[model samples]
Target: MVKLFNSRSSRPFRIILLVIAAIAAVAACAHADTPPAIVIAPSPFAWSVVVALVVVIIALLGVFLGMVNKSLGKSVQIKATVKKTVEDSYARKIRNEYQAKQALLDKKIEQVRQRFTMVMIKVKNLLDTLDHKELFNAISNLIEVDIGASRYVIFLVDPVKHELYPFRWQGYSDSAVEKFSMSVENAHALTYALKRKQTIYRDAATSDIELRKLLDREPLSNMLVAIPLFGKEKNFGVVHIAAFADGHTEIDESEIRFLSTLPTFIGGALANADIFVQTREELTSAKQVTEHEIAEKRRLQEIFSRYTSAELIESLLRNPEKIDLGGVNKTAAIMFTDIVGFTAFSSRMNPKEVVILMNEYLSRMTEVILDYQGEIDKFIGDAIMARFGVLSDLPYPAKNAVEAACAMMEELELLSSDWANRGLQGFNIRVGIATGEVLAGNIGSSRRQEFTVMGTTVNLASRLETLNKELGTRILVDEATFVQLPRGVKHQKRENVRIRGLDTPVTIYEILEQVKSAKIVSIQPKLDQLASRNNQSTDKDALPDTPPVAGIKRPDN
Candidate 1:
């Protein structure tokens, strides 16, 4: 029991021991004065009473200890419950804090995402447009409509002038905008931004006193931002944004960061716009030059047609590059026609009369030559030097030459009659035709050039014209040309003559007139052998009489 009490209830066990020891001493003292048996016999009743009292006292102590144990257990249980409730309250508080932080974090993340997306769309719009004005308008819309800036202006640099020019703006009048424009000498935020090649602002942390002072001079917003546009080469321009629409006093760091990227996009866009404008202008200028060249070529064609055949003019125009100003040898038929005695006739008549007669005669002759697709090589005083197959290939050059020569003679007859009726001295011309290889191209120095044929064939044709005076014929042709004529050509064969510049004598023929049936009535003229005389002596003293027999008057040689 002592071990149990010592182990279970140490303080209560000590109190019980002290009381039990005192009781034992009192019992010993009372029993010492009397005999043991006699004392026991007399105290049976008293013993019962004493036993009951002791039992009552022990029971009361047991009840008190039980109450103490129960009370102590209840106190321990209450402490445990309070501790659990406090822990639960702390856990609830921590959970609430965690949830509130998560909600706040989610809201921040969503706001960042939304802001990022909005900025991306604004940048995309700026990149998509290439026109200078359109790009400015897109920037304006992003600032005033997207970014919510109440007032804004876009400026672009003039590369040549090295000055800033207003590109676009919103919420500013013309006078206000002009006052706000910045240059190297200006005291504005744009100038400072450009100088630093960074952004300038008049806001919470950063303040631009110069810009504020500049704005104070005018009726403009105070809160402003100026970001310089940097290009590959240099700063292209600047953007000025001021006065938030919602009346925000300061710009957010996120907004400033987003606005900083605009210069890169806008600079590249402006460069591309410049390239497009330059390319379009170059194309327009090239188109105009091409049109002008075509017009000039047409004018040249018209002018060339007046000197050569229409077909030759068209051919020249089509292939102007192929036209060799350098000479080329070509097979051609050359015709040389001259007035029979133009020098002597002009001496006899006045200058006006000579001009009138020559104009009329040459006009008729030129018409016939052009109609037959002949190129007039040149005019030698009162003579015409023309070619049939020089610049272009002629299918029937020999035939064209013969026909043109005959037409000229016929027209000359009518002209002679007209001259006679006008009391002017009548005129006659002789024609010489030949066919052979000749050099045909532009000939002369750089200053003056003439497109003509040059060879033995040309000299032979000239000699043949002189031979007409000795032969008493109007039209004479070398044997080379006579044989190429069509079978139905009308011609009278003349004597074989030794033409200058030829090794051997060539047979010649005189074309009279084509018959009504297009058949030739040609006869080798019966003539006595005559001395080869120079044409200069044929009309040295006087001119021929009126019209001779076959529309040509020939003096006796």
Candidate 2:
């Protein structure tokens, strides 16, 4: 009972009892019928005790109310804290669910993005190739591996015959591929795709009889996809894919969509290949034409360079019209060279020896003349006639002629020493040069023509060459040639010289040496060595104890 009274439920009853006792006390004090002894005049101490008791009850009630208010506030705080904790836990669960869904969504998006990028890379590779074989191989690998096809064949369209021929194929024998040909008139999948210019998908269980019939001629397959390759201008070809090898009977929507996009790329590749082939053929033809032109130029050069200077041959080749059977009056320097004592030399030898000696002499003289830009006009027996400044204007024709003469003399000296060493007879040569206006061109009939120069200049040059024998000189130039000769040309003036065909005597000069620039310095040591050998041989043969032969003369003598 004490615990009950002290409990919260008993506190309000105690306060109610206290209020009734205070009221009863006050009423008894005011009533007149109450006992006088019991209701004696209330003492101050008694009144004070009653008042203190009331004050104590009021204070206890305030304390109880304060304690009740504090308990209620604590309960509300605990309830609010528990509610907030529950709410936070629920919100965390919801946020975790949202984040997991978002993460899954992000992973799916990333996977799709990667797939798209890979497909784009494959498409780019397909488009970048130009080789037809490589392109077909790439296409086959893509269809078989990436697009999940088991077998495939690429057919090229022949516009002329309106036929489709297997160009590149997989999962088929060479003979089978060779025998595969379909006409556009035929009811086949390739033809159907080509006519429709779209991708056709046919399954074994397809309800459409027409589609089934179109794929009947193809290899035994449960599913067949035919894509027509169309170029910018016309239909190029078609690609047929079969799904029979890997137990795949049907193509999904994504695979079908990917197959649908292959025609554009394949068609573009085919068009580029055609252009490449056509361009290669054109380049080959152009190369052939250029080669023929070069060959003709070389042939002409070989033929013309035999008789004229290389520079003249080049000019004639550049302007082909210049080579005609005609004559032109041009100021030129004419030079003639003849072997000294050739008749006596040949009479002492056989025909073979004579020919060999003449060839050697003439070849040496010809080289020297051409070296100085002089053209070999003709070979008169053991003589050579060359012309300078005939095909083109030369600033120093006289100098060229004199220098050529000097070179020829030097070459002959080397040849003479070489011949002495070889136990062969050697002869001297004479050169004559003259400068004047001459008719230079082709000078024979159409059937047999010769390019030569003719006029007073030619006659004068020949006459001067003949005059060398009498003057005991190697090279003689007429007044016209001497006057034009540059300085540093060593010469001896022979004034007022009479000629066989001239009315009056003409001035001539014997060319002794060439300028330092035109001299052949490299061969000097070789010439000197050969000369020393010849001198030693001669001295050895002329010993004091050896008697001189009566009929035979020394080779040099």
Candidate 3:
């Protein structure tokens, strides 16, 4: 058992014992306790009491939290029920509104389809023909009506000058009136559209100040739509639709696709029409020129046929310009044909009969010359001077001249039959063919040019025909003509003689029967025979009162 003691009772016993041990304890304590001793702290009962109070407060708080949790759960349940009900009600209302709006939008779409169909019908009316101004007026009117535009302008090209010109202008604002000229080159907007072969639209042209100035105040197109009439490698013009619609009236893809496509067809039609019109005008002018040329050619043919044969006339007609002042040296068989009794025949005949006879003989001989491809140079009275192998193209001129002479002789056979039919005997014709170099060209003064052969060769051919009367043959061909002639031609030895103008005496041959003849004499004796007959014919006319029944003595032969 333990008892509590007071401090006084405990101190005396401690002090009595401390006498012996106190001194020892005091010395050890003093040595150990040099820096001052601190007393150890004791645990407080007040702290435990404070801890108990905090625990009590925490327990109260837990109880209050439990009650608040139960009340808040009830409140939250009520609010959630109300919120869900409100959300479901709002969802139904909004859904109904959306369905009604969708139906209205569908109705609007159907109406737009109907109007677009009508617009298409009207567009077909414009495509009926490829007329520009008419189509543009219709299109601009459509824009002004549909889009509520104030003004419209159309520009087209002047076909004559190919310059851009204005077609029509509608509703002008007075502030900017008078200036409407828009050159295609100067119009960057229009040129760009045309070059691309597409449709271009500007919602606001007035916004571009520089462009507005060029437009010259006459209601600048707030919204300008252009379609290019572009064809296959051809540009006809631009179809411009100008309108004073608000800037918000922008052309969308659908409008561009519709407008630009028709322009392609329109452009092609315009191109076809333009080409046709131009071609028609050209053909008319060409016909006029050709008719005039033909008339001139026919007139020339009539006049020159007397001098040149028909074959030669055709060549001259084809290239009238070939007759130039130039000469060529060619070896030719020059032929001269003269009537043996021309002087006596002329003296016996009247002027009228002489002309008629001369024309008849000339026409017949000219045909013969051409049949042999001989070009007749000219006719000196009843005498004919023709040249064979006088050409630039014929390389074998010497050979050709012989062939022509052979053909000319053959043609003379036809005349015998013609004379029998005409009740008159054919006259003896003297033909002379000489081969030599001669100058053939259009020779004359600058005022006039005559295509004639010149030189001693021509003179020799003329003089040779006169020699035919002495040679005792129908045709006299020089040694030159005989050497060039092919063996196929029928020729016999005529005579040998010294040509008057030449130093050498050349041997000549005669083509007696071009077809088949026994032998025709040179017929120089026929010249005298014809002269005697001509005297009888002249004496009858000169004898004024010769009785019809009286036998007029035949003229002495």
Candidate 4:
């Protein structure tokens, strides 16, 4: 048996014999060891108990073996189940973490997209309006409502005036807003932004004392942003925004980035507004200047009308440069006419009556002078000094003067008759005429000047006027004047008289009337005819000696 146990050939048969021997040996031992007492022919209950014990013991043994086998199998199954559960739980945990991360990333992306979209919309809205007030209101609305900034202010820089004034504001009262306005030179933050041409932020650490103080004074956030309104040439101004209105402050990076691009639009709007204001001002100034010039001209016309005839005034106005404050030497006829006994006549009447009479006589004489296109130099007491051909070149100045003198004497008759009807004294006037070179133009101080003749010609005219009283004549002409008279105009020769201030005796003439057949009643007709004839003769080069036509008389002198 030992050999079989050790050998591999009879292993199966030897294992079966060994099992049978061990069982027989156990049965022999059970047979040899007997109990001390035994029950024979036991009762049914006792016998049943014994059998039940056997069954119980067998069942107990079977249960023990089955329990061992089940323990091994359960251990293996529990291990496998535990491993599968652990692997599923770990994988599920990793999946949940990935899902949570993806969800969070999607949420952040949506927020960023929404923020960008909002900023783009706001930027588009900002450019829609061009009105200054509207633009300011729109900008304020975007910052305060859309951009979520609580407080904001817009400052426009006036480069010409060198000032920065608050243009618009939000979240502040009128008085408070007024306080924020300051000069650009004094606003340190604004100045820095403008100088750098960039955006700047002001906080506790910023090195701007005035800005810090200003922030402290207003109901603004501690964190403030200043964005320069950049222009093509320079910065227009600044837009100041505050982070907090009245609560905790938070600054969004996107908001700042968005706002940094808005000043280009604002700058363009401001430039247009400024140009409009300047252009309007210039137009207003130009209108004022034009009105002033018109008023000045009207005033000048009124003043000049009082000194000369309307015709002379028109001529002077046409050539205003000729109305200078100096003298020009020219050949002209100066006539001096006065009441023959004016001193005696005035003494006999009251001052009022004398003025009336003098004005009456002077008015009639002035009418005759103006009718002949002569300038009344001045009215001296009851005497008149007039010049012919000073303002306009007369065809014949001496002839015009002679004709004016004759007309004056003729008109006096009607004037005296009217004065007689009014019971005013009637007087005769002595006239003197001289033709020579005289300084004729405005002459006097800057404050006041008179357009009158000054020279020996004027003096001689005065001397000749006095000779009328001695000669018992109403009209007298010096030799220089008499030679210019047309033969058709009737004049009588007077004796040679040495007038005062005259170095030599002057031949004087007494102008009477015009020859009736000649139809030369006044020098005006003769002058017109003369001008016509000269103009025709000049162009045709055919000078006619007989005054060009039969209707006109020739100057036989």
lDDT of 2 by residue, 1-557 (tens): 88987987566568766776776677566554654565356556665566667767777876787679679879999999999999999999999999998898777556545655666677678677644455566767666666666567777775445677776667778877767777877777778788888788775325677776656675323337778988777687787776546777676554555566677876776665542222222322333324444455555555466776545665655555554437787778999888888888889989998888788888878888877888888888888889998775665576578777887777888898998898888988888898878887777876977778899889999999999889898789876676444433566887688999889777678877543425433444543454445543443434232222221122221
TM-scores, one per candidate: 0.40, 0.40, 0.37, 0.42
| Candidate 4: worst-modelled 10 consecutive residues by lDDT | 541-550
Instruction: Compose the digit string of candidate 1's lDDT tens values, residues 1-557.
Output: 76876766456646755776666665665557663553343555664467557756965896688689779979999999999999999999999999998898777666656766775776676666544445555667766765677877776665334456666777778886776544555655566576677776666324444555554322234536777877676676777776678987566655666666666765666654432222222322333324444454555454355568545665665556545657888778899998887778899999998899888888788988987888888888888999987777775465578778887877777888988888999878888998778888778889977677898888988998998888788888876676555444567775656766777666678776443212321311211111113222342322221111111113222
Question: Tens-digit lDDT track for model 3 on 1-557?
Answer: 12423443244334434453544454455447472475435546554464456545555665566567668778999999999999999999999999998787667556556656766676667667444345555666655664345665545554334444444556665334336544556645655566667666664445766444443322234436766766786666665555545634566544544455556665655554342222212322333334455455555454455555444555556555544437766667788878888788678767876676667777777776665567778888788888876643343343455455545555555665775687645566787777677887768888976777898768877877888788666677665555444333466664447878887665666655452311222332443354444545533422221112112222221
Q: List the lowest-lDDT window of 10 residues for candidate 2.
A: 548-557
Over 1-557, each residue of candidate 4 has an lDDT whose tens digit, in order, gives 67756875444445445655665564455346673354445456654465456556555665665577678779999999999999999999999999998888667556656766775675566556444445556667766665567766777665434666676666667787666655567636666566677676554325665455544333333437777876676566777776555554544554455556656765665554332222212322333323343344444455555546655665554455554436787778899988876678878999998877777777778888887778888988778899987877665677778778877877888888988888876887788898878887777878977767899889988988888778777677776675455555576676557777767665677766443312445455665665556554432322221122222233433
> Which of candidates 1 and 4 is the stronger one according to lDDT?
1
Off by over 4 Å in 1: 1-303, 513-557
User: Whole-model lDDT, candidate 1?
Assistant: 0.66
- Which residues of candidate 3, in runs, are more than 4 Å off? 1-324, 348-350, 395-413, 446-448, 494-496, 514-557
Model 4, backbone clash pairs (residues 3+ apart or across chains), number: 0
lDDT of 4: 0.64
Q: Distance from true position, residue 545, model 1, in Å?
A: 41
Per-model root-mean-square deviation over C-alphas: 32.4, 29.8, 31.5, 34.1
Candidate 1 colliding pairs:
none
lDDT values of the candidates?
0.66, 0.69, 0.58, 0.64
